[model samples]
Target: MSTNFDEQQWRAELEGHRDHKDDFFATERQSPIPADQRDAFDGLSYFDPDPAYRVEASIDPIDSDDTITMETTVETEQEYERVARLAFELADEERTLVAYSGVTQGGDSLFVPFRDKTTGQQTYGAGRYMEFEVDGEVTAADTVVLDFNLAYHPFCAYNDAFACPLPPEENWLDVPIEAGEKLPDA
Candidate 1:
């Protein structure tokens, strides 16, 4: 696929998802925003889509069967099966992020939660999340698109009622990711 066309398509899809979430946050009963706060909610903030934030990453599958327990905002721990590590280049620097599968949510999806230098400044303080679907088992040969422009804040960033897993030190990036969702101003 053409790079320009692919980026355009990806951005359009991201905008659509943002609009849907805005609607839910404004009118849905299960919205993370409190009922009283929803009245003043305009929409979530986001950085303008930039193609530079999209990069191709190679998967490095972990051979061990060990599981990682991540701490949550509620002081609880959640277990995830360590599936693979994604290595890519961002901001002219090489970086790696651990990818996981929910221990109970099955292996159909890969979850990547991370914190960047922008975290607690331009983006959510707790961190953001990205998820991808795995077609069979992910291996070293797998090349996937890692798009920071699609990074999104966890629900806990909006309301305290929702508990979100904190990004481990392994997933913290030293570079600022000026893409995707920004912290909502209250």
Candidate 2:
């Protein structure tokens, strides 16, 4: 849905973002890369950035006060508000993903965790995630950008001590998303 787009600018920005993340993983103290491995960590693996994976989705706001307790990687749970459902098409298939507000996690951005057909093989086994901030509040039928190229593995993918919420069953997709971070080198 990204017609009238600037490919050069998008690629440049994406590269910069990846560079910054690599720097953090290689040097930052709060980075997910283990201290012992940081010295040898070159960078995280990623699928080549593809513009096709970036699509505009219509938001279907959940009117009721619905909440869900997501199972985490560390056998704990995290709560989130069912903010909205994002409707979009990927690989010629109608797909929908739930966008959540991590209220219990004290996060300010909209959280979206998902597992595509590529999961467990090409990317993180548990799944990958995307987060974006809405200017005000989500409104039904509002178009929002869903950039799968920005999907990332949670910190728990690199370290088991950090608990990461798993995507809900509804967010699991039958399509393959070949964009985004891939399984870290074992």
Candidate 3:
């Protein structure tokens, strides 16, 4: 119930998730890493878990039946419905990012692809993604946790053979988010 207890629980969960992903990337048959290189694969690079990057934002639903086409790393393109806008504060700055319900998401989860000041520098060049489900009955004014600590690189960042959608400009943030998965070591 204490802030310290909550922080400890969150850090442990995040670290465990990262460890599982490292194992998957290294040893799984369907891993992004080529078979020949799996032996030398250590783990994906990640910024240290920082609680400041975990945030809560209200969902502003997009009431129209509109969609957006996203450019991809390869020839194909992806279409997603702009489901909502999430406004949250990070480092004392108010920021907003669009959330989409794309073909790839199952259930009530929303896909949020974003590029920040860290892109092409500290993290993957194409940007990273976050996904969160709407728990319980949903409403236009619902609040959801946007955990940047769990943001991950697109598959294309690991191998060019897999095409991945680039984040739309509206989701681009001017702030540097110093959390989540970084570009893996070569």
Reference-based lDDT, each prediction? 0.86, 0.90, 0.87
Ranking by lDDT, best first? Answer: 2, 3, 1
For model 1 the TM-score comes to 0.91
Model 2 agreement with the true structure over 55-85: per-residue lDDT tens digits = 9998899988799999999899998999899
List candidate 3 segments past 4 Å from native: 1-5, 103-106, 184-186
Comparing 2 with 3 on lDDT, the higher-scoring candidate is 2
In model 3, which range of ten residues has the least summed lDDT?
Answer: 1-10
Best by TM-score: 2
Cα lDDT tens digits, model 3, 1-186, are 223448877989999999999999999988988888899998899988988898888888888867999999896899898888899998788899998887555468789999999999889889999987887634544788889999999888888889899999999999999899987551
What is candidate 2's local distance difference test score? Answer: 0.90
Q: After superposition, how far is residue 164 of candidate 3 from its true place, in Å?
A: 0.3
Clashing pairs in 1: none
Where's the lowest-lDDT run of ten residues in candidate 1?
1-10
> Compared with the true structure, what per-residue lDDT tens digits does model 1 show for residues 1-53?
22555766787898898899899989999988899999999999989888888
